[model samples]
Target: MTASEPGTPRTGPHRAELDLDGVRDEPTFLDRCARDLALPQWFGHNWDALDDCLRDLSWWGRPSGYEIRIRGWQRFRAAAPETARTAADVLADAIEYWAPRDTPLTVTFDDQE
Candidate 1:
């Protein structure tokens, strides 16, 4: 059964309610990257660094047609020692900036289930 089917226990904590209409028509991975880059400089500027950290731990990305969800704390701790603390702090701040005080921002795939 589908995730929305009645009695299907939710597998994840936060539900990312993505509205395709709200997403761009010409959506692509690059478009998503660009939008992510528009976040606060502190967080956006470190995207590559954060990605490298996650890559090193085999935590980022997935095979085509699949989706992956990463925990912020896990990614934070995986960063290089010198940058880990700062990365975690910046991530916390960015999360607060992007989400409402009552709700959290949960990243999810836009093009796949």
Candidate 2:
């Protein structure tokens, strides 16, 4: 049964929601993820570090899955296209890594203004 199916226990699909309303740089992006996602102290504030943390969310709790929803990134993408691409690539890799695992990972970008 799917997660939303009735009678299914809410063991989870733990979520981390990030609102980047005014953020437009790599530092801010990393800082936002580290702060909003409650990344561990070992997080090194870099793309590699972000990738590592996204792949290992055991610290966030052992949920059935994970969903990272990002909103208000149009401005960031417009301001820093390269950085946004890199961030997207890392997130995509994390999703792929978890797709075949028991605990899946998903990232959604909300383009609503």
Candidate 3:
């Protein structure tokens, strides 16, 4: 469940962080994700769109290997628990879509406040 301990990076998967603090809503959450993930200009800012960009990772110019570590999620959850839960589910589905390809993208969520 944790992605690479806390502060160290091995010469393995490319790592990214998405901070969920103050993300209380879908639009802001998507915006933060796009900024953090370096998503494309044509990013639709929706669940399916996020899935597509995450699967491709073409915008960031990094391919195949990625570990997206999400933090501060409890702040968002405290503000809107349902929204946070739904977003997590959507992202998990996206990761699942790419996993079987052998170019698996891992998304690990930290619920600590």
What TM-score quantifies how close candidate 3 is to the native fold?
0.77
At residue 48, candidate 1 shows an lDDT of 59
Clashes of 1: 0
Model 2, residue 50: displacement in angstroms?
0.6
Error of 1 at 12 (Å): 14
| Clashing residue pairs in candidate 1 (N, C-alpha, C atoms within 3 angstroms) | none
TM-score of every prediction relative to native: 0.27, 0.87, 0.77
Displacement of the residue 82 alpha carbon in candidate 1, Å: 2.5
RMSD of 2: 4.6
lDDT of 2 by residue, 1-113 (tens): 33234565546789998878778899998999888888999999999999999888878666788998899878889988998999889988999988988789988889798
Provide the RMSD of all predictions against the true structure, rounded to 1 decimal. Answer: 14.9, 4.6, 7.2
Candidate 1 structure quality by residue, lDDT tens digits, 5-51: 45534333332232222222223222333343332223333445444
Worst 10 residues of 2 by lDDT: 1-10
Off by over 4 Å in 3: 1-11, 62-64, 111-113
In terms of lDDT, the best-performing candidate is 2
- CA error at residue 52 for candidate 1, angstroms: 19
